[model samples]
Target: MVTKGAMLWLACTYDLDGGTLGHLRWRDEEVRTVILAIPTSTPQCSTSFPDNYRIDCNLASNEVRLGILNPVHGDTYTCSVYLSDATLKGWVLTQVSIIVPVPNVTLTSPVSDTVTVTPGDSQVYTYVTGSCRPPARIDWYKDGVNVTNQTGSVSNDGDEFVTTSSFTLTGAKDDRPATVQCRASNVDGMTPVQSGVKTLVVQCPPEIPTNIQEMENTETTIIVQWTEGFNGGQPQTFVILYRPEGGTKTETVSVIEQQQSTYTKEITGLIPNTRYLLNMYAYNVVGNSSLSSVVDIISKTNQECSYKGEMTSIPNLASIALFITSSVLLVTAVFLVMCIICRRKLRKMRGRENNPVAEAGVNLPLSPVGQHDISTERSHYDDLNLEEREPPSNYECLGSNAAANVNTQASTDDRQMYESLGTRSNAAVYDELEGPASRAHVII
Candidate 1:
């Protein structure tokens, strides 16, 4: 395939029509020179190719015989057809080449042709910006003012330039015709050829969760619950902090990203009955957390309180109010029922509900008033107990009182059954305990 001139060693192939049209591509369509030359000079094929390479080409035959030719011979001419010994005509043919234009562009964003963004708030804007060439620069503008954000770098994907522009709102005031226009140009400092603008609807930040509740009393656990996080986009992580009483330093308790709709953390080694400052931050990747809400945890046995807020899923204020009303009624009903059962038990012991803690072993005579008998154990209940009690612990007892009502009806055997259920299964509501002794409940 070596040559004296600048011709490349392009392919050289020959096709004979067998049953279909053969495929052949030639750069220079002009036939240089062809001959119907009969091979009589060589004893056989001097070049070792088929001898029919010279004398076989039929233009009229739908199926014809064809062969290749060697271009190595000198410029002299000796042309003759095979069998007939006639000279073949040497004519030139030309081929034309054409390229089609690209189709119309497609718009991927702003389905309604307008986008609504907030002022001073940053939002990541994305688009499939494509063109004949790479984009020089892609910028998103609003109302002729540049919408700024944390812009990521763009790379060429096929015939498109991909970039995510963070749209920051220094002042995305209410009802403003906020426009998100993605301008894409091929070269830097050039005019944007394909651009789209969408109107933005800017609003205030979502309201923070109300009525934060903290579970304390256990020397090693803290449970925080609130109304569901802002029901806008996906939920964000919860950042919690703990500051001991009388101390200014604070420690981050946890950063919960997934399953942030609810939060419950078991903090070990916390002091019993001591008050700790609690703060909760609800956030997501795209938005900052709502204002930090404060709560004080008081470790106590089965403490409960009502959380304040309207539910997000429900639409009717009346329904929400009705729900709150019903919940209160239910709690009050249980409290009354518990008060009844507790009074009956106290009557059996012939004791007051508010008996002093020091009276555990101070009585003169051991007595039984009814079938319900009060028997004193030989040793103190706290002495042999391995579990640590968070005496003096402070917490928002959201469910404790109601739970006490439910638990009071159950016997010690029932409590054991519930404890087994709580430990065997994952920590769900089943793990929550009731009554004054419930604060001692731990996972293990």
Candidate 2:
């Protein structure tokens, strides 16, 4: 069947020697036509036809044409041929019908409006219409709400019209999986056709955690903890950075797949008696957060007191023993050296006490003048010769020069007295002694 407003043409073939009348019938009215003496024809639509219909006829060719055909004209259409000649049949008829089709609606572009976007961002979207005999109207929806902010336009293709709808969307907090749709409709009032549902995903960066602290500490490790912060509406992971204070390089530790509101992490492989600076940050699908303020901490230095492991290795025990032995040896050696030095000084003092005269040397005084050299004279007397002579002992009265006129005389008693005085050879009498060179009296 022909569509509404389409042209309908009908032709009848006949054997004719004379002029004929051709009429087209639609509904209950006839389409009129006139044939002149020539072969040309004039056609007119009947009053029952649509107001915009036009008719044309070819009498010579036995054809009729209907323009702007409408369903209102009728379901059945008959084109008739009437003959003016008696020999021809009275009527020649051909029939057809007209039909108006239902409008088809579809979406051509943006099969689905689902998309991913950063939080607090804006985006542009395009929706196009699929092929439709009659142009379809496009409508936009966001979050299941009809959108009026956008405008649509139509363009012609080979046999159908395409409509495109474009719009801008500003992101919001609730934009995660935000649904968007494009619906098409026509005058038929049938069910509206739509594109598949679309979604806008909103991702965000992680927030900085709060109140970080060193929960536990030791010589070689520390346990860190903190209260969690907002996760930027998404899952997050944490990164911890630590370094020795005033150090140029840093060490890193990571915490992943974390979903809790608080956290604790242990850091190991550190040095004792060292200072450290610690900071932390978090990250998610969007980006990383700002680094937290750094904290200062000092590791314990007293390994023996603070370390948990035992110092039971052979080398350590041996070192302890060696240290004690060395200290004792050093003290003993110092004491021995001091004792030797003191002993040498005491011996030198004793030697000075033992030889005082020898030590005086030539400093002694000489004998006094006019005094006999008593020791030297005593030594000479001991050296005198005393050999083989009988003793004569006597008392004599001498003159002034008695010693000059000496005589040998002795009394028996005097001799006996002399004999009583033991002598190997001697003559002795009472007399005066002499000094070294001058005479002096002596009693004998």
Highest TM-score scorer: 2
lDDT for predicted candidate 2 compared with the true structure: 0.56
- Give all candidates' CA lDDT scores: 0.43, 0.56
Q: TM-scores across all candidates?
A: 0.25, 0.44
Give the per-residue lDDT digits (tens) of candidate 2, residues 15-74: 455555433332223434312122323233333334645555444565545554443434
Per candidate, the number of residue pairs that clash is 32, 9
RMSD of each: 36.8, 19.9
Candidate of highest lDDT: 2
**Residue-wise C-alpha lDDT for candidate 1, range 242-353, written one tens digit per residue:** 7778878887755444544555666555554568887766555446557566778855322232237432232346667999999999999999999999989876454322
Error of 2 at 108 (Å): 7.6
Query: For model 1, what is the alpha-carbon lDDT of residue 38?
Result: 22
